[model samples]
Target chain A: MITPELLLQELQTAFSKHKYGAEPGELYAPIGYIMSLGGKRFRPLLTLLSASIYTDEWQSALRPAMAVEVFHNFTLMHDDIMDNAPLRRGEPTVHEKWNANTAILSGDVMLIRAYDLLLGIRPELMGKVLARFNQTAAEVCEGQQLDMNFEKRWDVTEAEYLNMIRLKTSVLLGFALELGGLLTGADEASLQLLYAAGENMGMGFQLKDDLLDVFGDPAKFGKQVGGDIISNKKTFLLIEALSRAEGTYRTDLEYWINAADFDKNEKVQAVTKIYEALDIRTFTEQKIREYFEKGLNALEGLPAPDGRKIPLWQFVHQLVERDK
Target chain B: MITPELLLQELQTAFSKHKYGAEPGELYAPIGYIMSLGGKRFRPLLTLLSASIYTDEWQSALRPAMAVEVFHNFTLMHDDIMDNAPLRRGEPTVHEKWNANTAILSGDVMLIRAYDLLLGIRPELMGKVLARFNQTAAEVCEGQQLDMNFEKRWDVTEAEYLNMIRLKTSVLLGFALELGGLLTGADEASLQLLYAAGENMGMGFQLKDDLLDVFGDPAKFGKQVGGDIISNKKTFLLIEALSRAEGTYRTDLEYWINAADFDKNEKVQAVTKIYEALDIRTFTEQKIREYFEKGLNALEGLPAPDGRKIPLWQFVHQLVERDK
Candidate 1:
């Protein structure tokens, strides 16, 4: 079986080979631009990893695996327009680079292209895979809507937030693994286990993102640390802070959140101080650990023999351990 | 085999039974709203009619037929956003009724749901159907992008305008027929004939739309006639007039097109006179007739018996005869 690094290299090679540039330059150019501005290729790597656990012919999964990556980027393109986000991965978003109409239409094409890639799946498994994909794709939209709705409301519950993240981020991760399992001829039980494993890992992964936003080293995080606090983004930490803060803490946090004009660093620092007093960091870290353990348990419960699961287990750990 | 009328009735019943409403009412309500606002249901009717040409299992094609309608509405939802149009089918568009973000997200979900409906295809034919659907879906987006691109340029050629309408409006019509053929176990040769017939018919259909926009009787048209003239929409007639007009005719047409503000009725009258002077109406009618003949020729070339093909042929003629 290929190591995770080698599989990732292979995914990149496949993406680089897949030309997004086509006629109607207005539509395809932005698609090519976004696909070229590469990300970690993390979801596709998980797909390939999951496939390797069942078969040596994991290379067969590459095209379908790339489908997950393309769909992920498609979502990012449209979400950026809705969010009014100017930058993505330190580069201008599709909407910013071109315009929202281009982004929306190009994103729609990317989605169609993703479905095109899924056509590479074996015919016997195609229906099941597509059904799963459609369900996941709709759930992701639902999740985005929920996330947007939470923006207007102040009383977002932790359970609601977790479900939102699961739908928004985690489900695709789970679908990636499940798709791999289905393609590699994994039994239903094993596929369920793979989905659960990925879903749990995804939950932990999002929490890690929440923690990194507020507390991680800025250089290592590769983004503006405390961006969440600065924007009062309703992340797990902020939601927890809102839920747990007492009189003075609540009043102070509210002041910063509602402040129309203030020093960015000062607001971030003040919110960080509030988080510290409430012990939100520790609380979030513990929650992350719990989800990761649940993920590990799911992995152990997989029907695959212990040896076959070892590489995936190790790769997932290394993934979650990334400082950024 | 189901008659086109019976099949259409069945299709309507099927649509009425299928629910678009789901959780996240913000996302789904617009979807339900748009789906409920009745169009002619022309595309899916063609699907059912085409299916009846191949097999007695025409009823089996109803769900996949609805897929085409749903996908068509999805494009309209997004295109209305790009066009910033407020009305569709005499009703407020999704974006106007709700918001652009809601319309966009709902349209995305609508596309996913279209795929879900297509999954009703038999497993053996699933990949082929999905591949075709994705290809058609992408071409539709490319067409819309080209249409938007044309809005910024005044030098669009007649050929370019035709191709744009082909991409934006025609291919899906072809795909609708082809999807019906595929679902009914039509042979490849028959499917190709069905597709060509639909494509040519779509070209004619769009040209008729262009003609109706400027010239149709207002009572029969059911829409505001001269809308294309008022908006200076670069339709086939306008493109041809731009290409053919000379001297004073050219200057008058150009003046109307470039006018910052003008009386709506006066502009419409002037453009109508220019269209008459340049004989563009006759030229456009000639083109529409040519396309309809091409579509009929393809239908005649089908491997199916003359008897089996008669209903589809009659259905096509009836569809093209619509005044509104």
Candidate 2:
């Protein structure tokens, strides 16, 4: 009967309770600081909710749930440093408040703290839990490397970009839910299905982020619209436009892409025009919907699924359909 | 009866065998590549030697020993990036060969691989093993952060710098020996003494490094002498020199320290003259020997002490007394 909002609230409270205490404060305070910046907490909440569907005492999953949150924030702290980003969630990043070295060292400790939190899971499941976590951790690193690699090359394909995001972003989501199921002693089939569901939803969610960067209402988006477009970041719409554009349109797109100095508004407008000409946004939307459908289908495949799953499903649907 | 040389060779072979076979070889290859560069493998060899003193099957400690090696290299990879050092053990650093981004990612995966190796230890002892490893990991980060913080301030005290190096450099040595002892199920008291021994010895080893920078015979040092003095680094001698110098001597020392551009050799020679006048080298050597003696006392206190402990002690003694 719990709504997604309620689940998220519970997760937020749990995360706060486990917040780094005074002695290790320097090492872990940034983790609490970053997590309290009001992230979606979607991944950890999915862990708790998925565990709830199988077991009554979802509270047992709290520590492991925090592990996911800690791991996510750890990655974010380091990623912001690498990206030289000044702001995250419309606020100063950890490296901005603290130095990059502090951010890097603190992020490293946060990852270790994640492992410490994960060690609290039932001893019987420790091996499986650690194995899955290790794989997810490595994949996350691989995804990051690929994302960085993408920045150097001009010819990144749509499939390559998708795979990079899937590995870097979606796989963690998949592991978050799969971890919940494993902790709850769910059957192998159920665990696999849940992982697939989370992953598909994650793909859809990222696609939505890319779309919102350009098409979203600025008021609703909570940040600058077309930020990615101005940066000439290779998003799905841009990649599709690159692949499908012809002679004259292609030349214009190339000019905009290569131009080091141009009116930001003018460049965004011109690129948006090309995307419209190619129906790139429509194509991206269709792909997003396809993955959203796949995620829902995976959820549907669960045997005798509890009614409690509806709130999460509805939340995801709302996410996909959101303009921001 | 194993010499440090023989133990080092075995440690190298074991480290080389652990495949860091993650994709994007250019990114993850640095992990294996750096380990392959080989810096005597001193820490892991100490672990094996400590274990051998307790039990004959030191081979049982190989994985945990390798854990120490991997962890040490992980810190080096990240530290080189932070220090902006172009060389490691006379070879191009991971960041130099690949890039900072790749080095960061590869260093991350190396930490994961360290855990993977730690996981290979006997399951019954895994908790104590991981707990020690976690504590060591956090301390290492704390030390690195403190070292970075010290760089911004000129008032860094000798005690503060020593504490930083102890945390930054020595705790891992303590943990390595402690882990080896724990894996062999040595008595708790013996493990404690062994850890203390390693820690005190590590501190002495660091002091020796500081001493060698100024006082070492160039033929034995393998690099230009007084490199630390030339860089105006706050080593033990420099700190002592600053604390003890009076009037003209203090002003001259401050001048060299504050100078923007000066002959490197002249600065080193000027600092060396001040240090000689103050007998700071003799003072530092006395302090180093005191720690070495304390380390020996701790080693002698171990329960059911074995003769094998003698060679290990002798090896560490040799490290301290060596010109290099």
Which candidate has the top score in DockQ? 1
User: Model 1 — TM-score against the truth?
Assistant: 0.98
Q: Give lDDT tens digits, candidate 2, residues A102-168.
A: 6777888888888888766665677678778888888888888888888888888999999988988
Expressed as tens digits, the lDDT of each residue in B106-143 for candidate 2 is: 88888877887776566667766777888789888888
Off-target runs (Cα >4 Å) in candidate 1 are none
Those runs of model 2 whose alpha carbons end farther than 4 Å from true positions after fitting are A1-3, A19-32, A303-321, B1-5, B305-314
Task: For candidate 2, give the DockQ.
Answer: 0.44
Quote the positional error of residue B138 for candidate 1 in Å.
Answer: 0.9
- The candidate that wins on TM-score is 1
Instruction: Please report, as a residue range, the 10-residue window in candidate 2 chain A with the lowest summed lDDT.
Output: A19-28
CA RMSD, predictions in order: 1.2, 2.5
lDDT (Cα, 0-100) at B206 in candidate 2: 88
In model 1, the fraction of reference contacts reproduced equals: 0.85
Assess each prediction's global lDDT (C-alpha) against the native: 0.90, 0.83
Q: Fnat of the models, one by one?
A: 0.85, 0.33
